[model samples]
Target chain A: MRTEAGPPVTVVVGAGLVGASIGHALTGAGWRVHLVDAVPSHAMVAAGLGAGTAEPAEPSEVGLVVVAVPPRTIADVVGESLQTYPYATVTDVGSVKAGVLDALWERPVDLTRYVGSHPMAGSHHSGPVTADGDLFVDRTWVVTPHRKSAEASTARVVELVRACRARLVTLDVDDHDAAVARVSHLPHLVSVLMAGHLTDVPEEDLVLAGQGLRDVTRIAGGDPGLWQQIVRANATAVLRELRQVAVSLDRLITAVETAPTDEAPADLSLSRELERGVDGTRRIPGKHGSAAVPYEQVVVAIPDEPGALARLFGDVEAAGVNVEDIAIEHDASRQVGYLTLSVQPERAEGLAVVMRDGGWTVV
Target chain B: MRTEAGPPVTVVVGAGLVGASIGHALTGAGWRVHLVDAVPSHAMVAAGLGAGTAEPAEPSEVGLVVVAVPPRTIADVVGESLQTYPYATVTDVGSVKAGVLDALWERPVDLTRYVGSHPMAGSHHSGPVTADGDLFVDRTWVVTPHRKSAEASTARVVELVRACRARLVTLDVDDHDAAVARVSHLPHLVSVLMAGHLTDVPEEDLVLAGQGLRDVTRIAGGDPGLWQQIVRANATAVLRELRQVAVSLDRLITAVETAPTDEAPADLSLSRELERGVDGTRRIPGKHGSAAVPYEQVVVAIPDEPGALARLFGDVEAAGVNVEDIAIEHDASRQVGYLTLSVQPERAEGLAVVMRDGGWTVV
Candidate 1:
């Protein structure tokens, strides 16, 4: 049996994007990471990228086991991990938790040592080639502990979240699934439905597309096979959320159909639904899970040339105000780019003046 | 009567975001602009910002008139403009083109001098304060010429689009409405519906929200009053798109309901729908009305201190490769920012090396 007094060591099963990223981070933190995968090449590739060692020179000293396989294979792989490392805390990084736990009940594995984890850092791109130690930085990592999950096992998983520099949120196994269905799975399917319709749109008419369409459809470009597995594992919750959206969509259709011709007042119901959306969107937390703050943007028209940004940044630094955030907008057709600096509202006026004095066009 | 021999002159009505922006651009181009608004203060404020002169010293010899009022009031304002400025080409920058033409048929205004122009630079922020001369730069500006519209008036509208540095796409008036429904209006309602569900979600569960949910719902935060007017103008086409999505959604619900446990392989139709989304997302044009080109991102961890970006951009500029685009990501929770620079595929490796050698963390 492993003890907390021993050197930290972990066995990471399945060297995919999530697994490899965890391996990379644990290795960097001086943990002995044993990277294993069904595909030997994937394990080798991940190890070559300095994620961990593929060779298991010793096994009895393993302190924790992390299962990072696909959703459908998570139950089997996690079961194997618990049996292989009997004394180690076991956890599976599956997007869906209840499905894995329910499947595990039929197997002869120790439920007390197993917990469920889902790192809310999803990317369309997959594989070990895209893995990074910083992927989970400031991200919310949910740890789901069922009724049988031991407090010791949950605490060990919390250690992993801290090591990854992620914020921790403990939830029930089933509650975790429901939250993801409302936030992630449902949004993914809606994005897919929107993009799928684009398949029938004429290429020329698509010239009218804007940033809104681009953003709304971006997630639809994710891997279909992987998403299929994810949604299947959490089918019930996803269906509930999807049906709710469908009801609202039907109401929108009716509103659009009944609206009188232009120049006449319409029913207030459509406006109310739209206002609800406005409120909901405002409820989302700001980037990095920070509370949302009101920011005013100071727009700068930057010339596309060598050291233009350098000059701009130097001038901004001279103003002694930190730019809270920035968005750089460029189009191939234009030589000038619009770089919007989001700063505290109180500082916007002074920053604009400072920028304008620097001979930079502050739009 | 105005002639081509006279100096460039135009009367801008509405003095809102679109109108003020047009006035701003035209004034910068050395044209004499007379800005007017239903609310006298709007024109006064817009003129104060150098959009144009609110006081019209002379009314004769006006070469063109741009009507940029609310969508519901466009036809009335535009008809009045044509009657007020005889022999001048008249155009309205409305989101829905066919509605305006449809409403105009009931009036006695000459159709020869009128054309429909929709500057596809819609922003959630409105009014003159949010207006800029560069708002229309490289944006798609659609000009809709009806069957009876004279070629000279269409040419004048085309020139206005060019003066604002926007790309021109001329289509039939009714076709313009259909295209916006599919590309703009429908996506908007989908975004709204998706966000509307967030109202019922527990605030704690919303912490699970990622960039995908935020992106998909960002447009939902737009002013409900403005969107109500827009969707109403293009109701028929918006209704058609929404019904089509509804049909696809019903199929999705059935697939979700019948799916078996996680370990089993399910139907292929769900996967096909997701794959179609992947294909459709790939079909959207790249930024700046350009064809989509494959670019690789060189991720740089920028410190949240002054002169950090200056040094980074300095190193990047020294590499002698221009960054095709840049996305600046900063979270208030972290002291470090991830600045992803999108460059041509061939230049990424060299740029990364340059950044790393300069002591910047290239992730």
Candidate 2:
């Protein structure tokens, strides 16, 4: 392996949201980036958005080539990128790593030059228009390199992750697939299945939806074509999780069906399932990848004006409290919105007092 | 039926979040309000928070008695309230209207004075301390009065809904149950089941969760005890939906299992299911009860400082654009946040320009 001087030159193929975002991040990090896409306009659009120049990389000149394509095409694209740029270490940012690696294994491609990676970051919106340079910041980027993969190739991908400011998690192909199936793919399908029931619901009934329904179905709004491919590519792992979920659903159904009509006794099985849900939720990592810490939420009523939130944050800062997270609750017809601020438990009381003293209603 | 005069006196039983909120709203609307709870301290706290006076209503003096109890006890509370306040109309705000009404039918209580109502409003936080006077403003209040309910009783409940500034949707008991089963109960279970899967997830994998998982599992964090009662009360309807979902999952699992290894063709059933999900998501009512309208989202980068949101909103107001909705996205370790502003499609470009010109990053 030869060491290159100055900023690394990286090429990003497939100019969709992830690809364009990678290009944008790499360009911002002083890496010379070249972008390509099957649809030439997508590459041009991504380039125009300052992601990179819409030019193919010269042979042996590129240090790394990142293939960000649909799951079905990942292996093909990664193989082509590897063969096309002999000197560059190749990586693909596809959701399903095992299938792609297996597909490549079946081919005559050089496995030593390639690594499979997936950045666990995305937006509801797609396309280059929604591509953001800082999209990968603080996100986990999982790299799955097989036994045949060269150490130099894996190091090159790690360099790419560093340039994008994403945390790195090294997992084998099967583990990456299983982890994503449990965390991402399974949840996506669950959201889709839940939202699917809404198709025939009356408009009047749907008008009664609250934040809970919104949260449950929000990801169901993703492009169907993209999700179909993802689900198909990770079919084995996703099927395993789906089967587990189906069994759980059946158990819950039976628990509900056999529940006493007239409150004979507490439904132990039903309560146990709900308790398990609480346990599951508690397992989700809080900010900074720490164990999920229950934060004290302080609800403040803000006038529906432009500067109200800004002013509230100002007051929160003045009170020496850090706002960990916030959610805004507003109705179209209401002139006031409630801003729920999640903060450290110890800081909540003081912040509430400060806000209340500053003439804000804190509940 | 006797008509009452001069700002109708209302009594709210069960001083939890919903009941206290109703009390607060009614008191603010010029009603003589009284609050009661099985737990005396809960009523006292709600009263001290200015929701209402912690006193029982005099016989024949209360114009309306609102029973906001657990679903299992709703019928009993509503029946007792109706008997105690002989001249007053009574309503219960249990989630499952049909179950409560059926429980009432099994009793000797008069049905003419009682109405089954549910306000489709809530927050993740529970209890009286989290109550707010405007909680029901712009929310749908479903009144599921049976055939035996008197016109006067239904009208009185409508008046209460009006006083709270909530939109009213009148449905028969069975229809209300079915509608909620499709929209609310089923989604809640899906969220719970999805969250339940996370119980055994490794912390390293849990850190990979994104917004999709967050949204899907958010409501799973609700009080399990409360949810257990709710699920049990609506078991019949919820079970029906659960069975349908289980079938869908089974079908999806089969489709994935039988999928072509070499991507010969897309799994027709899998694609169709996902397409149905897209259709379903589009059917959800948007702001102001309109059909879901796709809004153009403009991303604005805000400095991680106090008043950043306020300044952004101020600039947005200065641009004379009404933000349809806004979401704040920030990483725990990041010093900047992305505020995704949803606006009228035509207004998005102009707002982006205005934001960019105002020294904000618009993507």
- DockQ, per model, reads 0.63, 0.59
Write the residue-wise lDDT of candidate 2 on B1-363 in tens digits.
436566678889999889999989998988888999999999999999888999776777788889988777887888888788888889988888877887878688878999889887774555324788888787778888788999988998999999999888888888888887888788888999999999867776776776678879988888889888887888788887888888888877876787764575756788888888878888777655666678888988777665566567768877888776777765433446678887789989998999989998876
Q: Can you give the lDDT of residue A331 in candidate 1?
A: 46
User: Evaluated with DockQ, which candidate comes out highest?
Assistant: 1
Question: lDDT per residue, candidate 2, A1-363, as tens digits?
Answer: 336686667888899889999989989988899999999999999999999999777767888888988777888888888788878889999888888888888787788999889887774545325788888886778888898999988988998989899888899999888888898899999998988878767776676676678779988878888888888888888988998898898888887887664576867888888888878888877656666788888888887665566567667777877677788765434456678887888888888889999999776
- lDDT comparing candidate 1 with the true structure: 0.83
Q: How well is candidate 1 docked (DockQ)?
A: 0.63
lDDT of 2: 0.81
Instruction: Put down candidate 1 lDDT per residue, B1-363, tens digits, no spaces.
Output: 666663357999989888999999998888889999889999999999999999973546787899998888988988888888887889999899888888989788898999999987735433214578888887778899998899999999998998998888889877889899998888888899999999989988887777688879978888788898898888888888899999999988887777654675666778888898998898888766678877888878887776677678778888888877777765424446788788888898888888889988776
Which model scores highest in TM-score?
A: 1
